[model samples]
Target: MDQNFSIVSLVLGASTVVQFVLALLMAVSLASWTVIFRKYFAIKSARLKTNDFEQEFWSGTSLNDLYQAAINSARQGSPLQRIFASGMREFLKLRERHLDSTTLVDGSRRAMRAAFQREMDAIEANLSFLASVASVSPYVGLFGTVWGIMHAFVGLSNLQQVTLATVAPGIAEALVATAIGLFAAIPAVIAYNFFARDIDRLSIRFDSFTEEFSNILQRQVAPHPGQGAAAPSAGPSTRPMGAH
Candidate 1:
């Protein structure tokens, strides 16, 4: 153990470039792990909360009750809850104006769609950094390796005799950087892909919920008394009084 520690110290001391590369790899590893764990918990919580909310939403609960619940506990509510709240609020607003069924439904759909986009954006935040780390780490490691090798060769040029022991330590130390980079990168790439797929699935669920909510709105509006009601004109009619 002491010998290994001494070798590591030697490697770290021999090339500043290697030390920098290792430090970068360590940072990437820490960041990737943190994101992985955070996203895991976040996605898991979202899925569970979404499932619970869906059950309540479709279980004959009143829209007003659901909206209130969502507003009060919205931090714990999932994307579905927010979308439903937006749609219901818009539906009520349009209903108050005595809009026709088609217009009311259209307005509600628009609100839900906007909410869905917002939810997706939130869920996908920070994913780009993970992708960048995965893609760039290997190149960064290679740069360190190249620098270390150049340093070793420069030393070799000043030596009268070249031997295996003289060159092997530098090469081994250089390769360690590449290995560390791969260690950091591979898991990050895999986790990024996994999380991306999960988010896509959740997005699909959000879309389906929007469609189902739209259908529900259509049903609610279809039987209203204001089926084809239009807005009152802002100005007086142009026709002359009693001209008919």
Candidate 2:
């Protein structure tokens, strides 16, 4: 293979449309990778923080103390912490109003639900772009390949006779687009799948936590038989509940 026919040379020698496609694919690949790296770290950190909060929540810590800690942590708090805080806050406010157990639980659940949605939006950010790149990059590369082949054939039409030597370069140049396309698509697809799974797992965890927390709140608010209204407590259960 001549040095002139190297991958770099073939790319540089590609037709204008082919070059444009290559550039577009490369840019998309770069952006996808950036999102992948950022998402990886963000999700990892989220999981770790959730774990820490779970341990603290179930460690017999008082709800008031945990709520104060969550408040102090502010924006630095994990999704789980924020969700807990939201529910606890609502529960306290409703409790002060002398709301029934059902009303207290429902209001706290709504507040937690809103916080969960916001956290999910932040957690799943930029995931759609990864999905788009995964699904579309290959076709973009194929477009470049087809265009390169058409251009090459048109060039060959100017030659009186064609030989293998003359045909190979054009074919190779056209194939390079497909190669680059696969290169870009493979990682994006893999990362997309991985992130999707992680997000789903996090969602499940959040849901479980919400239900368990709600149950704990319900238990505290529910009045004892033959007794008057009982005071509500925000402390977590001694054992974690099995997920449904």
Per-residue alpha-carbon lDDT of model 1 for 1-244, expressed as tens digits? 4453354665665588788888888888899889989988888888898999887776666666787898888767878999988988888888898877899989999999999999998899888878988999898888878888888888888889999878877777777778778888888899899999999999999999898878766765566475544322111221123422
lDDT (tens digit, per residue) of candidate 2 on 42-136: 99999999999988888877778899999999989889999999999998898899878899999999999999999999999999999999999
lDDT scores of the candidates, listed in order: 0.80, 0.89
Clashing pairs in 1: none
Model 2 worst lDDT run, 10 consecutive residues: 235-244
Which regions of candidate 2 fall more than 4 Å away from where they truly are?
234-244
Q: List the pairs of residues colliding in candidate 2.
A: none
| Clash count per candidate | 0, 0
Cα deviation in Å at residue 230, candidate 2? 3.1
